[model samples]
Target: MSKQLPDLTPIGVVAIAALCTTSLLVGVRSLGALQRWELLVFDWMIRLRPDDPPDPRLLVVGITEDDLSRFGWPLSDRTLAQALNQLQQHDPAAIGLDLYRNLSQPPGYEELVAELNAPNLIGIENDNVDPPPTLPEARIGFNDLVSDPDGPIRRNLMTFEIEGKTRYSFSLRLALHYLQLKGLAPEVSPTGAIVWGKAVFEPLTSTSGGYATIDAKGYQILLNYRAEDRAVETVTLSQVLDRQVPPEWIEDKIIAIGTIAPSIGDVHYTPYSSTSSHPFMAGVVIHAQMLSQLLSAVIDGRPLFWFWSEGVEIAWILAWTVGGAAIAWWCRHPLLLVAVSAGGIGVLVLTTWGIFLAAGWIPFVTPVLGWAIAGSGVVAYRAYQSGRQQQIVMKLLGQSTSPEVADALWSSRDHLLKNGKLPGQKLVATMLFTDLKDFSTISEQMPPEALLEWLNEYLEMLTEVVQEHHGIINKFTGDGIMAAFGVPIARQQPEEIAEDAYNAVSCGLTMSDRLQILNREWQQRGLPVIQMRVGIYTGPIVAGSLGGKERLEYGMIGDSVNIASRLESCEKDRQSSICRVLIARETLTLIREQFVVEHWGPLALKGKHQMVDVYRVLARQQKTGEVPVEPPVDFPQPKR
Candidate 1:
């Protein structure tokens, strides 16, 4: 009959879900800014260079210190012509010169121009207002730099407007050139960005004029770099000029040459940037990434497209919120609850990261925060509630009962206080009423000090007997004690009530014997000894907490109680009145096998409509150091 613990998970979950939803909305509204920051972090973390075998289609021909030392610094056009002529012998698939040829060089400038007119050559171009016209056949595309608002090279300018006409640039332009070389003219949208066939581009909504917002979904770029040198065949300008390396090293290879010197300030700080800056690597590496991307597009048919990761965020948030709440509510052990919550968070984080890597989607962060917050809140609340419940139990049962009974009472208070009615439940009970038989006479014989001390000692011993049998003492009248069994709570069986009565009888007999020794000692001292009479009855009765608000006590008031009190008074009528214990017929019937009893014929009892039969217990049968008392027989035959 203990109080039921309240469940708090559902409430906690609802609160967390609400917080998550709100956080999600806020995140979405700032999607563009979040995406930009995410990109910044990603760009800082992801290594652009390949850790294994290099992609076969991309090559970097470095303009190294070795090349410079071999050919002399800022070599004349004649020397450049010699280098170009040697490069032409290799017949590269495409050649991108990272240096601009806007001004004339030296004697072989025209021959260098003739070499630039080759079909697969691309040149770098600065964002100048005007420039001299160049041969269309040699200039496959232009390379232009695009930076962020803070002037960091974070975006690739695929196309830009010049003189009110859109012109393509950078790696995208090179990809277009490659496509044209393969006889596949890439479809161009009206906006001048190349239309990737069958690839859907859902641009994120933006409020900044016609400028498209860069959400986490809207940009998808890949890179390829080989860890091993010469993974993609490369012939330096010195090698080409000296014919030291094979001509086929560059033949049909997509050759990219650029500065890699740290002093020249040509190196870009990519996510993979390291201390070793071989002067010509920055532009060459970017070109390599672009080339690999283009080859992957053709061979693997992997299209880059935007996916809204918002749904994933919302789903994960709800999952953790519910899961955390469940753990907090269902787990009784504090450690287990904490372990479950932590394990849930770990699983969520791993799942989110895995899905992001596999499907390119980002989950919302607020859901995770919500789950943590809700779980902590629930645990704290549960602890507080548990403490409060314990305090209420202590307040109610602490003082009035024996420690053991108080604990039992507190635990079963729910059942005891059901419907707030007195004598709340039916129970098979034994009622015991004990009166100080000659207490007034003893008090008159003894000094007041001695009388009070003796009474307290007697009552203390008597109360112990009742409590030991799991019986509650209802109250103590001036010179008497009333105790009830199977009450305040109920016993499972009627036999237990009989057992309680027997125990009380045994305790009374022991007390009477012990008092004889005390009386002998007191007689020597010229003081009176006290005597008591006890009555027992067992029957069904209503038992529960009773009394008004401030004076509540667990008690039973019924006909059985009245009969037991009457039986106690009847003790004086017996021939052998020295033994002062009497039991009613009802109690005797339930314990016939236990206690041996002599019958007392039916006697008129006050406040009762009928005469009641009773019995006087004689002795108990002994077995294995324990005495077994049988129930009393029917009242003795009336004398003729």
Candidate 2:
């Protein structure tokens, strides 16, 4: 038989599972929990990178508790002027006073105002604080950092509209001033992003990276934080005022001054806070880090964090979903599947980590979850299909077939079965039909219960004989049985077909002997004894499952099957013994060499148009220790 069509069930299952899982993850991501997980993973990826050395061009002067004790809260204007004067003398590229100097703390206000007029000094302001009244707007930048809802600073606000005018951030102002000193001024790219040399600073959107619903009102970008230990070079405000700081540390570097004392309450959480002993970084250090980031990207060619478009990200997640399902489909063993699935998840995580290291921010948690759910769906579907197939096979073939045959049928199910049912196939094999002689008369002689018991005992013996000879009892018609050899699995070789015919003839002979013993036992027990008629034929027949799903059975249909049944009841006066076996010329042709058979002549079988030569299989051909010549006779050819 030709091979059946390839099964599309697995592919279908994978597609639906992957699609559904992808959709679910996408929906869940929109609900925010998945987005938060992805952000956490992003932080971990950042933390996992090799430590970046402290940038030599950035310095932070933080006022500590000692400074507060020495100069009191809100340092006097004279003290502030002294610090600025010391920093200016070092010839720094730009000085960013992270402290809001809008309010006056006077004792020497004139001195503070005069020092703030330096061309490179940038004053800080916030929504609640104004820039120094004496300082020009060109000399001011807002010292505000954007924090996520969960309280970690991860983005830098570059510029925002205030009273229909653009105001720059503290970090941006310092970075731009430092770059301008090196003759590398910022310019707007064709796409409207900030461009300096080959670096393009793209602003972040509400959906950038792992952020799903961020308030992206101002121009912002992902803050790529450096290692905590070497984030920036720092010195105390008292040290700056005492002129103890090295001039080289300030020369041509962007200097940021702010408070770092715990009592000052200027500390904020950062991505490294979770793993660091100090879970917060001073606000001054964050501004220095942001400024350093911009300078490095523009001058040193360091990369900025990037992200894939929404469409590309979705496709990437779907790819992993399909991959997970494919892995499950290839691995049939549960242990192997589990092992491979774990490995698949490991590979996915590593891949995303590697990409993150390259400054490409893509989703990790969503794809991992999607992969797991899709693989599980496929596994569950396979389990269901396996149980369903087992039930259908048992229902159609029954339990009479031998274990080896049943296994073989199951193994070749991909080729033998279609849509949970056996497809019809044409094969050249033997069919055996058996009937209890005078079954009607025997039934009348006993009550229903006793008759059922007697019939079951005889049928059980017949089923065992058929199974032993590798034949399947296709179905039962009242007291008669229709059994087939070389069924479910087609015989590919002519020799195999001939073997099936030999087994069918041998099975009939065994039945004759088995019936004799059964009759003797019944006679001894004072129960009614009965005879049997068995007819065997070898020819082409179409075999497959019959009836709908609710009621099903394996059945054979062909002229050969009808002939087998007709031979069993052809002539009642022809019984020569208690159990009789008659085979057509076709079956006799294959087993004639091994059996002694009597030629009963050609006769027209009921419902058959042509005459069929019948033979009586008496017993095994007696061997005389010598080869015997076979007689030749003309045989009728079967119509195709």
Candidate 3:
């Protein structure tokens, strides 16, 4: 058995490709780049979100710069009281005084406390301070905003239990207060989730998008900011205090109060705000966003932001890993594979965002990186693989074939090394046997070194012709050569086997013609001319590696090979010709019209039980063209 081309590249390529793909997927969920990309894709989705007109039921009343300039920095308690008294007359549903009045900023302290005691005035309190601010417990809520690590608010803390007291957020309390007047009070479900009217807010945990471990300390949920336009109907504190505000703007409206002064207002970042020249929204407006989302979820049936189950996300990552590996394996060319991978990434992003725009939270980063890792990694492995295979082929063929031919074989190794390794297989091939005529007589007349040099010249010429015809020279015996075709690489179709047959006969005839020209050159150089007889037999044969583990040679072993060798001896045909080429009838059937053949009839060969029909190949039929190579200047063309 001959040495097989070991499977080096394919298995390693698959393993490394899989490893790289998996690493990319894991990195996407764990690495910071993936998190940033997820955020960017999210921002794009937010930017593309359709805008809605401001809700008519809710109103935003803020202390604008004009109001601040009029009311003097921190408005005195009397000014706050005067604004409150004016709002009371309008019969608004609820009033959220977003400013913290834990310490009195007073010109009229007694009057401000009296106005603060009103049932609709919701005061803000801060828990971050050492001595937490005090408020009328019934009308107070914590004014705390939960920001992501990027310092932008995307989640809402509806209600948190602190020191056994269930404290609500500034927005949730304000919204509840407004809903209560309309006979829709906030209720807690048996599951401990807040249900505003009919909408149950699903809370966000640490596992929410890209949040591996977050502080989920409260009744937190994703905050979907109001659409692009100014969603809140607004009026300033000065307008309300000066009695310049229309009654209808405050009447029956859920009014939220905050300062819009860029200098003094509590500002925070939000999604919709990113599109503005000044992206920071007032703390009160952020709270208003929370309230609007809640009310809209209940009344308008708006969908809440949601994340995929952990199992589903893992499966998605795994799916992309496999997809990347498959694409890498199928496309081995580096540049072409990269282009394909780029196209794949583009499609993934477009499809992911398309689903996101439709309210589906599909991931984009993990999958695409998996594709690049698999694709580029596979391309690298195959390039290494090609170099290794080329080395092996060069090592095996030795100095018999040219570097160009070896490179050509390396480039097309996928055809030769099927499924990574070549296994022993039965195939149909042509075996050509060539022996120098009168070699014993010629060799005895020359010195040992001269005869050896003489043999090499003939061998080189024959080997080159065999390679040109895509045949493998197996071995040299004394002064004869044995070559086989369609070995190691099996032919899948019958037409391929016939082509192998054609190549064998063409190579034998070319060697004969080249030898006659070589004879003229030898005659001029005062060297003895030589003649060689060729025999070709085509049939079903077993062609593969042959020998022990240390020494190996690929060759064919069958009756066809034996028959071709026997015919090349010239003694079996009972002919006296100097050098003639004979082909078996089995081979003749495949190339009957392509050569000028003489029927030599059935003749029993050495070591064969029965007689087999043979034909002498006189000459090859020229192709249908006028130009012949060299124009036969010295030798006349042989006639049919």
On lDDT, the leading prediction is 2
Better of 1 and 2 by lDDT: 2
Give the root-mean-square deviation of each candidate in angstroms.
8.8, 6.5, 5.3
Roughly what TM-score does model 3 have, to 2 decimal places?
A: 0.82
What ordering of candidates by lDDT runs from best to worst?
2, 3, 1
Residue 41 miss distance in model 3 (angstroms): 1.8
Error of 2 at 513 (Å): 6.3
**What is each predicted model's overall lDDT from 0 to 1?**
0.58, 0.85, 0.73
Given candidate 2, what's the lDDT at residue 59? 88
Clashing pairs in 2: none
lDDT of 2 at 514: 84
Error of 3 at 611 (Å): 2.1
Q: How many residue pairs of model 2 clash at the backbone?
A: 0
Is candidate 1 or 3 superior in lDDT? Answer: 3
lDDT at 508 for candidate 1? Answer: 54
- Alpha carbon RMSD to native, model 3: 5.3
In candidate 2 the C-alpha lDDT for residue 403 amounts to: 82
TM-score for each of the candidates: 0.62, 0.84, 0.82
lDDT of 1 by residue, 1-640 (tens): 5663543345654565446544653465354444444444334333332354566655666666676776665656677667667777877777776665676677778878787777777776666622214646235345544433333344444454557765655465566666666765556577634456443323332321111253222222333233323334555667657778666567776667665444445655443443334312355565566565555555455454233454554555566666665577667677887787778778876765554444243433444555665566666666665565445444433333466666776566544443333336877778888887656666777788877777776677667666665666777877778877655567776566667666666655555555556656766876655556778887777765566534555557678888888888874645343346778787777667665677877888777889888777665645666655443222222222
Residue 146 miss distance in model 2 (angstroms): 1.8
- Model 2, 199-222: lDDT tens digits are 898989887778888898878989
Point out the higher-scoring one by TM-score: 1 or 2. Answer: 2
